[model samples]
Target chain A: MRKKPALWGLHASPPGLLKYVLAALPFLVVVLVYLIASDLRHDVNHADKLLPGFGQMLDSLKDLALVPDQRTGKILLLADTLASLKRLLIGVVLASVFGLFLGVNMGLLPGFRALQLSFVTFFSMIPPLAILPILFISFGVGELAKIVLIFIGVFPVIARDIYLASTQVPREQVVKALTLGATQLGVIYRVVLPQILPRLLDTVRLALGPAWLFLIASEAIAATNGLGYRIFLVRRYLAMDIILPYVLWITFIGFSMDWLLRRYMRWRYPWYERGGN
Target chain B: MTDTLASKYQLVIQDVHKSYGEKKVLEDIDLTVRSGEFCTVVGPSGCGKSTLLRLILGQEDVSSGFIYIDGKPVGLPSTDRGIVYQRYSLFPHLSVLDNVILGQTLRIAPWSARSKRKAFVDEAMVYLERMRLAEHSHKLPSELSGGMQQRVAIAQALIAKPKILMMDEPFGALDPETREEMQIFILELWDASRFTVFFVTHDLEEALFLGSRIFVLSQFYTDQRGNGQQIRRGAKIVADHHLPKTPLSAETKRAPHFLDLMESIRRDGFNPAHLQHVDDFNLRHPDSFRTLSPGEGDSQSDRMPQLWDKSQ
Candidate 1:
């Protein structure tokens, strides 16, 4: 008879150098395949076709270093991209902190979620573009409007996700904790918070994509420097070379951000076995 | 009839009644558990066995009765009464060790004799080791099986060293093999710990095995005219809830003794009128109590101290 696997040691395989070698094989294969295929693809050049082969694509990735002269525009674009990244990063941090507080409060408290959900949905429904005019009118077309826009874009999704996560924590656990001499706050921190955190980690990562999308849009309109503004500038002069490269750069950054998120999720929450849920 | 207090007596529950919105669940339940007695309550589903447990723990309100633990009214849940639930009520986020130690942390009396948090933790580890869950201290509840999770739940409840432990079908969800193993494990643990336990189960055989005394709760019967009735048609305290006489702990379902008791109970279960007839028949022919069959006679009484002193 086959014995059931010991539940405690489900993930406790002994570490070995060979294990890492074995695990890396699939990823290494994928990388090699991508590199070979990218090299094989060639493109004919036109004067208007500023974006050339994958070599130019690789060069543009390297060209993040800010240079003077004709490259100054590109360098300024890189700086703007970095600034946008910084703002998005800050917005995520702030929203997560604030959202957790509100989400938990709303989750635990009976009437609070109903009241907050209506208001959050109302605000979230107002498209980021629609709010831009009001934000510009109020805070001017500067960093302040951009920050508020990012906050608006990111906070609702987080608060809602947290609300769902915190509320979704099993009722039995909460009741058991309370009955076992845990104070209300003790129940939240000790029992409720731990269960909610992993899903919320996924939530925040998911929210980052939209946050970047809205931030880029905000920068495209009013900002003089940033990657979005630079992209718009290159578009006006039909500088497809610069425009296309920055687009590729944005895609790569987004892809890397998402990949890192996936890796972190896998490392921290291996028990989330149900894929594509 | 408050005679001599048993040597290791811990709690005395006297007439605890619980009702919700005029729906009385437990009506006048009275029992006193000695320090090490494994008293189990068994009945059909929704027979207020759970309500009796909640009343003892003081987690729910008693509509018209009271419970005393060590001769004091139980106002609310306390660490002195540890409860192990059937469901996996473990905090999923914390590791097994942390879950076990949660009860001992924060809000313990500052002036108490037992100081130092690490000592309490070490003591908790000993209980975990008893359940064979010591090595999984760092693993989260999600990484455990149903049986392992229940063991951790038991370890956590026992960690506080409560005087009276209450368990609600702790082995209800496990498979038959695991269930029997858990039953034996709990029995041994109770023997070692010497804490009085109040266990609730729907299985009568389980009740007979584990309980030093068994309290049968009346079924939920609703009367007409919009009132709820607890049909206590043939309800009374079966004082000696211990195993039957004859050194025959191996209970066969086909045995005359077991079959008579099961048949008698089954007849009462389906027909309330038939239950009253059985009682009347017993009363009319007290000397010839052979209706229950000769084999079932004195089976329960045999486990008692002696036949002469049994009534007293």
Candidate 2:
């Protein structure tokens, strides 16, 4: 037989130090590209507003995060972080609660499913951003509207995910639970609920990206404080330094949220299969 | 006498019939499972054995007639009856210990369970020890072997002390060697516990080896309804035999009589061409009876002229 090329012949997941390096390669490339661009841009104009030097970004970060804002005596980064986190928390938590309730109940009880499946599906399909104006008008441009926007963006997705998860808890488990002396309510809350909780955490982790998107969009549109509002606010001055740091901060925050959820699920439900390595 | 009462055929199905729209599934199944009896049902594929099990489990309602458990009509699945499926025999999410304790935990409130946690675990441990799953109690179903998982499933079901335990091809997923080992293990468990089992399988040897009474369900039986209406044939118990109860081993499967019974069952119910008339079905169990109503259930019995003589 002819010798096949190594790469074309077979492949398996990279192991050991190679895996770590492979993971870091993209980040390394991104930083290298940006460094060269920043160096070139700064060489052209000493006070360039576009693509500020790395030192300038560090200075901006130190100023916003470490130093108190001259106007309000609050650290700008901390203030923005706190505000955005509060809105995200309120929105995501409420959405999760509502979604779990509706989704599981709908899945378990056919009558409830018949009543809500069509409505929930239709609601889920509606572009949440399209109704921002209506929400702002009705709930006001304050915390309510922002939180509602996040809730609207995320609940349907989580609901659908949770519905699918709960419904797929398997007929064998249901019958087994019943035969084990579980009442209808006991089967739902005890048997089915425990089985789907890990799935709930997983769905919530996936919703984080969209949750951030909705939070930022809402904040950018109308908020006086928050990472999105601050980023947009600094844009007029072409403050790429502040924008870049803030963008990185947001990415880091989203990454942390996902990691923390995964960790929690693993810790609490050791039997949960993360599926991906 | 407790012997007479215990052997009273506690589970009775009278003239049961089931259908899905125009397609009938189980027709005129008059089954009587004696109390403290291990009844194994064998059938051809697509012969409605699973449908019959579902009806008995009360997961699905019977289309006609009634099912009685200890003279009381059966409702939806309850702790009175338990099931072990071939594939999903155990909850994958729960630990072996939790799976067994779950039977007791369901009845007690969470507060009470908290107070009685030690007691529950202790009780569950007894069954685990019997199942040889004691050392693996804290592990999930995925961590165990297929036979071990099934043992845990049986322990979980038996923990509840159900009156009847239904196993739907519980050993179907095992390799042949493992299956034989499991058969012996189950027989041991049966000897110890004596919980009435309604075991269903497509394997005739499995039926003969595992059961005190074996019922053969098939769609190959002749029906009075002519071929004009495109009538979909439903599964019926064509032959019910009472086997000798003994302290048996899987090795008994190799005996001549065992193979002979297996062969006869295969020819009787598994063959497509060897269609036996409903009246001539070889139902020979002592407790077995023809409970079918007139016309529907070979009502005329021996009075009718022989359609096809069995004594060739």
Which has the greatest TM-score?
A: 2
Candidate 1 lDDT tens digits, A1-277? 6554333366545347657876898989976875554445432323323434456555644555445337455566557778878777887788888778778778887788777878987776878778788999999988888888888888888887788777766655665665566777767765677566667777887898788787888888888777787788767867655776788678888888888877887788665532211
In terms of docking quality, how is candidate 1 classified? incorrect
Q: For model 1, which pairs clash? A: A50-A241, A51-A241, A80-A226, B244-B299
lDDT of 1 at B106: 37
Tell me the lDDT of model 2 at A70.
Answer: 92
Over B102-220, each residue of candidate 1 has an lDDT whose tens digit, in order, gives 77663454344156667777887888899999889889888888889999998887776677888998889999888877877787786666677889887876766676555555442
lDDT score, candidate 1, position A10: 63
Candidate 1 deviates by what RMSD? 10.3
Q: How far is each candidate from the true structure, as Cα RMSD in Å? A: 10.3, 4.4
Off by over 4 Å in 1: A1-45, A50-74, A111-118, A121-123, A271-277, B1-36, B51-77, B106-117, B220-312
Quick one: best DockQ, which candidate? Answer: 2
Clashing pairs in 2: B9-B34
Candidate 2 chain A has its poorest 10 consecutive residues by lDDT at A4-13
